[model samples]
Target: MHTCAPPVETLEELLEAHPSINGNFGHLLLLQKDADDGTLSQALRPYFESAHLDARQAFHADIGIDLHPDAGDGDGPAVTYPGCLPLTTRKGLFGEVLAGLVTEGYPLVGEHEWCVPIFLFRYHEDARNYLFSLARRPERRRQTVGRLGSDFIGLLLDENGAVIRFIAGEAKWRKTLNQSAVDTVMLGDLIDDPAGGGARVRSGKGVWNDLNNDPPVPIGVRQLQRLLQEYDPDGYDAAILSLERALVVREPVPLPRTDLVIVAGNASATRDTLTCFLPFEGTPPEYTAGHDLQLVEVVLKKGEALIDAIYDSLWSENADA
Candidate 1:
């Protein structure tokens, strides 16, 4: 689930934006699938097939999956062709990949030549552990959990190989973009009174809360540094050194940060195409950003079935005949 190299061409052809609304704070864009999903799904399939490339064996190789001498002896895939990832996991993954494509394809606030050098798919230990369950003789107990830090990260590097800007995002998918679901995620969940009669109040916990309180330097940057050092040391040598300088104890180099939030889901039958989960006016007061902010709302028709279809077809063409 790493690098699908940006510019997923079909995205441009498939999703049509409802007149972009520009404001003093940032831009708001609502993209909906062009009608005729049968054609749309076929067009979008290849990109996702590439996006969900089975990374189990490749990422785990460095983590000791290769120690078993029998590994790679057969020409067939060693891991699950398509392990049945939980519905939530699949939706979350789709959101991240969709956000990554948007991050790479769409223009940002200030400076925006973004590239996701490597996807941190290896960090998906839940997926990794799940694969292990099916691969071994006796199935291993599944580790049911979610990742801790950033949902997805992308960056822009300068000529000198120093990181100049970073894109950090939180992408979510819901079957319905109803008010309660939207409010609970973006703002915070309302708490009920113990006596069952008091007014409900926000819990002070949600996407906005997490974004506002993120550490100056994101946890993903450090994680990216480690992956770069391991996977492509020579290719990203200077990049690593630059990160080391920034990660140092005192007088660290400051990296400009950009935050993105994408909420994509099935559109309400009665909802207008222009309707969006995020505000269309000036930047929401919730964003305390010292850097840039981007928002995307992708509304689809029958998206769950499309997602399942696309994920099921990943790597299918390459099956051993």
Candidate 2:
């Protein structure tokens, strides 16, 4: 699997999509700006603590550690928070669900290790590209090591819930996932495949290195075509499949849901585009357009049973909305 972050600017947009967040939570770890801080926990502590209530909280939350680049030219810390769950176990009500999304057929786009939002479409930074490579730049380090800037950092899992990828995506979101977006996702997947995303993240042309020298095919154009052929026979389905494939591989699970649906992107594509091509859990999609966004609802037959245990735990603990 792979990993990436949501754009910084769109955090509000995402929060708005959720009923839980009547407005932004000051307790949430919103990026204060880019810096080369090495302590991801420091940046996230406030949010975690705000969400934490008692001892059993540990059962719901887990912490992870790793490293990334410095703010500018050096190295920094690579830390992770299972924000609410550990990456190693699948014992809780949501545990199997997290594992299944990571291990199975769908893409896990916009999900972080601790289940924080890591979708690339939530941020507004430009995708980093250099003359020789195509990868995002790591952050610069600050004198005092603490927290990461974006929520995209985390662990990724394969279909069996095995960690396959880990990364810190740039804080750039896209409104239109046109050719550039497709190319970006495809290239990221290729470079981060056999070799992890760490080596090439700061290097330009990591994936595009051979583009100028190799057989004149655009770096990921061919692979994109092949992926589309297999997962998407029709054009619209191809688009949804592309997005789904990228997200699932990166984060290794379906994105965290706000009221049971992934409401993150501002893509102009229709609900039918997603249902027709990249359907999940066997639910047919139904759409409702609001002034701010489009709402696509899918009815799951076993929905109540599947989430009953999870919700029951929440009720038992007196969890908040």
Leading candidate by lDDT: 1
lDDT per residue as tens, model 1, 88-200? 67787788777777777766566468867665555777776666665664345343565678877887888877678788888888898766777888888889755567878
lDDT of 2: 0.26
Point out where model 1 deviates above 4 Å.
1-3, 18-24, 34-46, 49-54, 58-82, 137-143, 193-197, 319-321
Backbone clash pairs for candidate 1 read none
The per-residue C-alpha lDDT of model 1 at residue 17 equals 60
TM-score between model 1 and native: 0.84
List the candidate 2 regions with Cα displacement exceeding 4 Å.
1-151, 155-172, 188-265, 269-272, 275-321
Highest TM-score: which candidate? 1
Where does candidate 1 have its weakest 10-residue lDDT segment?
60-69
Each prediction's whole-model lDDT (CA): 0.69, 0.26
lDDT of 2 at 24: 12
